[model samples]
Target: MTTNSIALFFMTDFSIPKPNHNKALKTLAPPSLAGKGAGGLGFSPLIALAAILLNLAPTPAIATTVKIDRWSTTSDRVTLKVKVLNNNRIPILGLEEQAFRVKTKDKFGNPHTLQSPEIRVLSPEESHPQQTYVAILLDMSGSMKQKDTARVKKLDGAVNAIRGFINLVKAENLPVDISIIPFGEGCNHSYQVTTKTIEDNFKSASNSELEKQLDELAKVPVCAATNIYQPLTETVKYLRNRFPPSPSEIDAQDKPLPKLSVILLSDGFHVYRNNEPQQFENVINLLKQNSQITVHTLGYGESLAHLRNRAICFKYIPDDRLTVDDVANGCRLPGSDIQEFIVDEDRLKKIAQTTGGIHEFPEDAEAVAKSLKTFFTTLREYEIIYQQPGSDRATIHPTKIEINSPDRGINTLQSETENIRMSNFIYRALTFTQRLPLLILTVFIGLVGVLPFIQWSKKLKQQSDL
Candidate 1:
């Protein structure tokens, strides 16, 4: 048929969602003569049909809301804190191992499928099965002496806040070994809280004694300056010593090594003496090097903007070493010799981010306690253990993780795909040597069954001959 005839037929037959198709034709046609009606202007219905078809066509699937609360890789396994939300944005509970699949890709986009990854849904009420080691690092700079509107000193409020954290941990029955580290000027080993000190105090002390110890910790005199860097190195070293070199080491040693988490309370200032820039570099490097250590920074007493701006400089120092040139470039204004006094939030955030931890700046001491308590509640997260197949452990790999409802077929709403880069890459080879015991057991069982069958057959044949 001719194009004009087809257009005419479509225009006459098609219906439009309006006063009428004739009115739609009038609207589509440009007004040249006011007297002209809908019949004179030619309008085609094919355009509307094409538009409907375009709208109806399938589009790319949207990712459901999901939060990767924390993730870390080790010599033998990758651990993740994943929270999947449904369409209503609530955390979905009771996910099994079969609900998740992990895909690790090298820099070149080569996919490495893990043998089996474990997934456990965390319950906010219950404590995690693994033992936990926590070191609470309290900043004792002079500014911490300032009181809020409630007439309570900052230091006192912080101590009270931490007391609540300890109480919550105890209530949850989390097997936690706690340490309180106080940092400031001119305080050598005199006022520092070490893991040994906490363990020693708790070993013989009752609950009331523990409270007394906390009071003693809170009473540490505030110093003129803050030395966040040195304390961090100490805390990380202490926590790392608690963890085994590999996950398998925990099994081999037959001891429960606790997971390490550091809760640092600071006024969001890094005012260390002597090479302040280098101190920042050291802290950042320490966190990056120890990926297993989770550092949560709680900043109070300053505007978050001030805290966040100071933190941006940390992005420049990817490694431990900080040259004058690096500082001049990172911390100073472009083409200006004058250096800007920066806040410490950015670096603090980077430390938390790299270690799969979190940073928060609460408004008050009460808020601080509440946030810490909330954090402790979410500590019970699922663990996924998968066998690594690839040999390349040096390069960073991009990982895409998927979670689903295992038995709910076809219509199940998948969790949002998590795209993250894997750090602290450790390669574990899956070799036949590890399976020797199983092989031996299987062979021995087979031989025993065969020998019994042969004996029975011989006895039956002898009976028949008789």
Candidate 2:
């Protein structure tokens, strides 16, 4: 199809909501557009790149939604991560086990049920001295020095807003550890993957340490280049070191395996100074290798967005005029090559989608702050565990997940596909503390059930021998 025809097809066939640009979108609707069908669409002769990126649209604004991240099953236990968002796209936390009415189906399309449901506030990932590790990668590139309409340096705005978000996290009183990395100060030109630290360090400090470190962000000098790849690599490396890569290892060594997430706030573009782009691919590999780390991205301004357009446009701009904004933004008129920039929502979205995280484009610092608060609140999640007999393996997956809305209605959330691998579990892996009650039950069964059967069988054998 011609460029105009393709653009018209996408415009009519899908309903990907435009970014608020003025405000961060509130509700992250489940991506069920194709399932429900499309609305009327109209388009003029435009470009083809716009049509393709149309599918990459972030979660639409719809009713409440739920995403089942993954199902990790060991022989003895099952850990599930379900993310539920309200109509406003805000996360819904504090739901008790009763609220999670789960239905099950097997891979064979047969009836399946999870026996002996053990709902615990304590799991490998949450509760019982809960710990959550959050890392904030802030962009302090030279472009950050540019002032907004309010004459606020983008860096200062982000700093002040993040400071407020930290206070909000403090109020939750949950065990949340936060680390701030301000990258790209002078290192951009020097070709070093460096940061101008708030506390002059690249440490993931928690509690009061965050306040001291954040104060240094505004005063730190800005740099001319950015290596988005380095900070992403460092964040993943830190978390991987702190926690084992698999659920089995986590359950064996840790009492409560903490939740891991990273927030990348930037206003410029990604610099390839040397091999940053290639390194970015490696970083993506680490994330995909069962790290279970969610990378939430916030595009702070228009610069990054512009760069994203250019990247998309580069593929289709008339060969005669290769430099232009993305087609979706109507960069049909060619100009100089688009700059390498951040706020590249496309790149940010890819990272977030890889780890089942959220991505937002906030226009200014205040909007950025609001987005940060949403991040803090959404980190609080409900972890559910299901168990079954040691000798049997049952296909267990959540079919229907629903919750009673505060507004006097029941909101039903959809479930995604999951993988469950059963193990040859001869005995349940119970902790020493859990074994006591179970020990008593074993003795009771022996005396009342197994012991009698054994004695009768022995008596019969003796009679036959005589």
Candidate 3:
């Protein structure tokens, strides 16, 4: 087909550049587009039309492009990246099926596809089609100084678990983006210390550097006040900006919004001022109202019990505390006879349940490692694609996402998904008062409706006076 005719299908009011035109079309077309003698100046109209039709024909339907990311932990949880490409190495978008299938050998050595019903689909785009953001929030409070054993510290436990989680995510071999945010008295607002750096520096850093940072985390003394709201608010703000409202607000379809998954870690109570609860509630309620982000909280110590209980009151946690003995172990240092090292595991569990996150208290290095492994593995298995009805700027649209799996002897799972479906809602920038024309019309209508009744009442009063 002529380049002009080919351009019609691919371009809208905004046109693709001439240089990239061929590449874009090739990425979308079937193999027939590459056939010999398909393009020529002297070809008959009929021949040209036939060639064009053949090129436009869809490819044989098989499996859809499903983006997959894997994450794990070493000393803490690590965010994993997974990108799915076609044979031409171009990123695929909105695949027919976006679920992750694990191929493992059973005892007989036969490969089986472990069909995990949970799958998440990302928005479609030519470049960076698969965008994923996983946030690991580590709690670095004084309670983390507790001792697990004579030789190892509780901080050591936290580091080991986080490190192991990171290692697992790296093994997944997907085009994934990762971020790490560590919180204690308050989240490290400094750019150098926050997880936002992961978008740029995480993948490039050597394993040694990653370990160095984790080691230094212990030496950094915990601040006195444990303001969980600050970090939580910061995390929500970052994700909202990162994801934006929708395609229209974003200005271009080529830029797909990143899927946000927050993993929070804390070992202290949320000491917000009396007014702070309302502010925290507003922020969280705004996030829940949007249906675009999923938050998972991990509580680490006995101090966290209060925070966990309060967090659960809001139904934000799915499970209880993700405590590591190393945090308690760190408190029992030599010559420091501190008997109260173990954190309240029950409280931690409640926090996890409220936030819909996994709660576990790992006693040693091995258990910590295994817990990290499970957490990452579950993340890799579950998948979701956000489907809001209108523009991201619409702000108040109800979002509904349907997860489907045909092979696992399941026909439908929508209802079950809804009850456990995490809130991804956000508030629109414009409030009801700002859209005042409608408000004015309603006021006018109310006045009109009440004016006749007032007039009738006045006439009756005058008649009675007569």
Candidate 4:
């Protein structure tokens, strides 16, 4: 409309109201906030509305209050335990998938975004205070009879340190299932996981059968030398059977099974059994198969570099000889085949790394106990189950899982998980077809070698008949 038409329209439609009681009340109202801009009573109506809108606007940021506890991945799913708190440092629960945005980064430092990922929030009772199972494999081999430079007997140190740890577990009142097996007492299948100290709760941990076994182990040293293979493999098998990945109880399906931590402590190298090295490898594989299991190894009393010259297997350890296979399988380090004692700190470091656990070399028995306490506290309480939509294209082992609140009211969270196995049928088939030529060539070579031998045998038989 033209300015003249606009003035005529407003004059006709919104003509000035006649003086009345309502206008008198408006005249007497507080002048500071009353609308007054277009004319004497004209309004800047947007000022209060603008303030209200700003107050209701979404907050853009908050201090980081998220910490990851522990995380693991299935072939297809990534599970994580984390602590998420609001600005008030209060745990924020009962949130839906829309409340979080998820993404992942592979071990190679490449990024992948996930879309509409499903999130399952477990109940606090089901996860946050879940029970934890720990196995303390104390070496009671003959070498325990030796003492450290501090005059602390290896056996006494192990037993006493264990005694202290058990006390700490009780003091903390942590819900745990523990096993204290003293192996290396006998050779072959003679030694076993005979001492099991388990409790549903922490109150009964003290003076349990585990303590009784500890008391007995402190006084005596085993007749045989160190045999890490038998004890470690047996422990893993026991844990796997006891706390299976798939639970049978109906209530357990909603949550995950408790994690198992195997603490393998030894002062000397592996010996006694000739196949200890191979058996140790099998133990590592077993732990790897179950992502929930972590093996924390402590090389007590000595460092890995120092143990080379003092080959415990060759010198003080009994039977003191390697089998033909043991000699062939070779030593732990780059040295004479006879120089190793099977399980050294060098090998122990690798086991911890492969299982996603930490390896610590403690100088004495006190340090050993100190390390044990540290591992127990790191157990996970809550788990987040989500499928990474980009897992199909993921090439790395342990992709990083990153979590953020859409409103930025929580800190960014990160956890790592391995990619789902290569499940594409075409990929598996292609890999097989890729190796087919080599397999066929080997078979052809074998046939060529067998035919000449068969011909020679037939000719000899014919000559004898003549």
Candidate 5:
């Protein structure tokens, strides 16, 4: 045997099967005598140690996977949960919470600035929340029946988005129960797909059943007018009815309130019940009052402002009196048809803002699917601790947050200013609470001063009578 082959045979454990066994053996003696016969096999203990060192060396730019799970805020402070998949081999070692930029989009699609979110990674790291409750409110108004392209309709895109969520739930095996409520003219509660839950240990049969229910929602007929308020209002009531108003219900249940999320898809405004368009604002405010709920609204086609403007034009002028040239040139719309297909943007914004939810406007049918995926990313678990913005808690506050990771491509998440229930101590900051102690001291001082005055008056009156 050659000197090199002899050295290699000794260095490696030849008894262990490896790719080069035959070639090494062919150049040497048979296995039975090779260890004993190959002239001292030139093996050193250092050689084995060197091989292990090479394997342990670090690679270039250690890859990182950061996912934004869930984010929430008090009226002032923002907290973010960022799931860092590779915590052991983090690319940006010692990354701080201040390294991210967080912002929220307005009804105009403009992202307003906010403070950087404080980041926290949950212990015993997880990719998904243990459980979730989703209410998918789909709009089945007459406008949804309109064709997007020659072949695709708006409802087709909505179904695709629903299918995307179903596939996501199955792939992740998330324990989520979904309720689908289709609304137009009024909500068809009978036609609604009630809650379907996926157990902790996932079952294929359960998944198939959920998929079948989604298919049913896809087949609901399109109806005239839009009752945008009913589905949202009813779904909230349904959720409340499921659980009684007891603290123990939240504290004792395994998944208790399991993160309520409402995904509302609408093409236009509330015109079906014409007298109460303003009622939507009240319903949205009610959603905001419930701390457990977060509403994500997706607007399809034109902006709500554009739709409302067209409706206003039609309300003032009758269609029969308008000229065809005026309609073609954009001078005036056929007032008769304007309110039938309008979207109230300001009311939608109010709902989202009060509930710490997101509002998205996707211009085309295809964009709807993409936006749904983005919304799904928000349904994760992580926590952040940061200084609360010192603002008046009694009134709604204007909050702005921003998070950025320097020297990395990690995108900043949206932050919001909404109602965050304060503790008894922190609650003292709101309204008359701060001035309470001072007011009490003032009253005590006044009582002491008035008592001395009364005693002096009584002594003087006694001397005069004597």
Candidate 6:
């Protein structure tokens, strides 16, 4: 994705809503002057100050929305779209120059600033464009058995879903680097398949090869233990290594990394031996920590409810669970009743809510295909970027974003987008080393100056009274 393909536009009304006025002022204020008193100062001075501060404050920066017209044979690039908004419901705009300062560092430790001309002002109806790598993590454990007689196996459903997802991405002609990690006892070596090979392979995958790889999974006996933690850790390690060291280190060796999309399928409860909640928690923590990876978990069989509940309660679980039989029946019979069960509908809903992915129960192969299609459609429409306010590196920071589109009846943001929607406005202070010195200096300054000012003010007031 080249800079020209991405466009960013801003909408500025300068009209501050009542509750937002304080926040607007706070954000607009210089870091040094953030805590100054408002007093009884009237509206005019406040407005003047606000305008000056807006002009002097850092202009709102936005990630460029690049369009991937076609995959480059020489380099891989992913396109994504990012939208900017303020505390008010207004979409932020009018500061194109300021948006250019937004920088993304590649894996190689070099920073690249977003190009200004590439950002086009988006109208309310418009969407910003962007892209990234798509990392697929598949679960090939033995527990992916089918409950129904007519339905295909759970592993088959997963593989079919993956194939469809890959095809859709390729059809877009986007430069996507496809990596397949099949995890059973452990993760398989990543198949860094190129767009051409992926397309050709899908096309020429003989019915036998397709059936063997896409629909038939190695049915290890139920006794085989599922080691989900290993794969999760391995995948993350692979991604951290795969991403360019930094954004500016673009060389032949530095082909752009695809935004990561992880699809994890399993059926049994997470392996717990000894006081291993810590192990499970660690896996969850790793998933939560990576902002770049979107994890979708598909839980088949009786344990679907448990897996769905866990994934839904945590942001690390991106997609909802779909029973293997339901998906297979959906594929085989379209809208027919496949007698598939939803163990915990509310919990599954919550999982879908917490993770940015959807909860779908496919009744047949076509329905499975449809679910995959829907997921890919949402993926295409997503506004992906790697920008966290007040930080330069891609470290994990909790965020909440709410979208109130009354006209479209879109009142909520879900999945990865929902992370930007919390009400608590606390920012986790940087690590101790990064904050201690500044904290000490602040205390010293307040003691030396603010104490003296307070004393002097008190003395002056006493004299005036006398």
Which candidate, 2 or 4, would have the higher lDDT against the true structure?
Answer: 2
Compared with the true structure, what per-residue lDDT tens digits does model 6 show for residues 216-249? 3443332234555566566665665555333322
What is each predicted model's overall lDDT from 0 to 1?
0.57, 0.59, 0.45, 0.57, 0.53, 0.43
Choose the strongest candidate by TM-score. Answer: 2
* Candidate 3, lDDT over the whole model: 0.45
Residues 1-466, candidate 3: write the lDDT tens digits.
3211111132122345334222321224455554445254343567756777766664422222233332211111111234433222222234334443333232233433333243233332212223456666676655566654334555677677777777665665434555556665443432233336534434421245666677777577553445566666677677677566552222245343555666665544454446754765665565565445655554443343322332212122223433322233322324542323334454445434444445655544455555565455334332333222222321222122333444422233221111111123334445677879888988999999999999999999999999
Worst 10 residues of 2 by lDDT: 1-10
In candidate 1, what residue range of length 10 has the lowest lDDT sum?
Answer: 2-11
Model 2 spans > 4 angstroms off: 1-81, 85-90, 93-99, 104-129, 185-206, 273-279, 303-342, 383-466
Off by over 4 Å in 1: 1-128, 149-151, 187-190, 193-208, 218-224, 247-251, 254-256, 304-343, 383-401, 404-466
Cα RMSD (angstroms) for every candidate in the order listed: 18.4, 13.9, 25.5, 29.2, 23.2, 26.8
Tens-digit lDDT string for candidate 5 (303-376): 53333333323232233444222222232334344433344555566676676566777756677886786566
- Model 6 Cα shift for residue 110 (angstroms): 29
In model 4, state the lDDT of residue 28.
52
Tell how far residue 267 is off in model 2, in angstroms.
Answer: 0.8
Highest-scoring model, lDDT: 2
lDDT, candidate 3, at 128: 28
lDDT of 6: 0.43
How far out, in Å, is residue 233 in model 5?
1.1
lDDT of 2 by residue, 1-466 (tens): 2111111122344567555332221324456532443231333234334765665564333336766544455665665566766554456554445545444544454545442244443221253325677778888777777665356778888998889877776665667777777677355333233333322443333456677767766776676566677777766776777676664324565344677888888775565635645765777787898557888888777643343333433233343332213333433224432342335666776787777677878767777787887777666655566653332454433344344433323355455544455444524767888999999999998789977899999999999999
What TM-scores do the predictions have? 0.52, 0.58, 0.43, 0.50, 0.49, 0.41
Among residues 3 or more apart in sequence or in different chains, the pairs in candidate 4 whose N, CA or C atoms overlap within 3 Å are 398-417, 398-418
Q: Decide which is better by TM-score, 5 or 6.
A: 5
The candidate 6 region of ten consecutive residues with least summed lDDT is 68-77
Judged by whole-model lDDT over C-alpha atoms, candidate 2 comes out at 0.59
Ranking by TM-score: 2, 1, 4, 5, 3, 6
